[model samples]
Target: MKLSFLGQSYEASNPAIAATDTGETLTFRGKSYSQKQFNVALRQPTEELTYRGVRYHR
Candidate 1:
């Protein structure tokens, strides 16, 4: 999966991404750098997930 934060001008490749509402602050990791509220949007759904032999939430 990949994540792009327009507010922060930052990009990341992983299952998750984080950033703040203000463009001044953002983080590629799961943590955000700005105090402003931020919204996270997933670009792609997980290909597959397993939980105790059962499929995880699609």
Candidate 2:
């Protein structure tokens, strides 16, 4: 999906988006971002992201 963050737009695809550090960190297209950044950028549900075998509660 297309998302905007920090006044920048990016195209995020499936499986490429994941989170670590207990949902504190988000990785997109090989670039690492904070959960807050991702949340602001993402227009879709957080459930669409792949976690570390755990469900993320945001």
Candidate 3:
């Protein structure tokens, strides 16, 4: 069985705020997000997945 959760994506919406580098940060609309969220959304080119804005990578 596969369980899933809803998440946000960069494609449908333009986050408006953005950042670069490890220490730096980004924000979707006004909510703050981690670098992984930005990377997975903008860089990886992978399918949509759950991103809780914590523990960016496994």
lDDT of each: 0.59, 0.60, 0.49
**What's each prediction's TM-score?**
0.24, 0.25, 0.23
TM-score, prediction 2: 0.25
Per-residue alpha-carbon lDDT of candidate 3 for residues 7-45, written as tens digits (9 for 90 to 100) = 633334333444355765788889995663233344444
| Number of colliding residue pairs in model 2 | 0
Instruction: Compute the lDDT of residue 49 as modeled in candidate 3.
Output: 43
TM-score, ranked from best to worst: 2, 1, 3
Error of 2 at 38 (Å): 24
Best by lDDT: 2
- Candidate 1 residues lying further than 4 Å off, grouped into runs, are 1-37
lDDT by residue for model 2 over 1-58, one digit each (tens)? 9999999787776544443445577789999976642222344554444368866643
lDDT of 1 by residue, 1-58 (tens): 3456665443455444465566566776788676565456666654477868988654
Against the true structure, candidate 3 has what lDDT? Answer: 0.49
3: Cα error in model 2, Å = 0.2
Better of 2 and 3 by lDDT: 2
Which residue pairs does candidate 3 place in steric collision? none
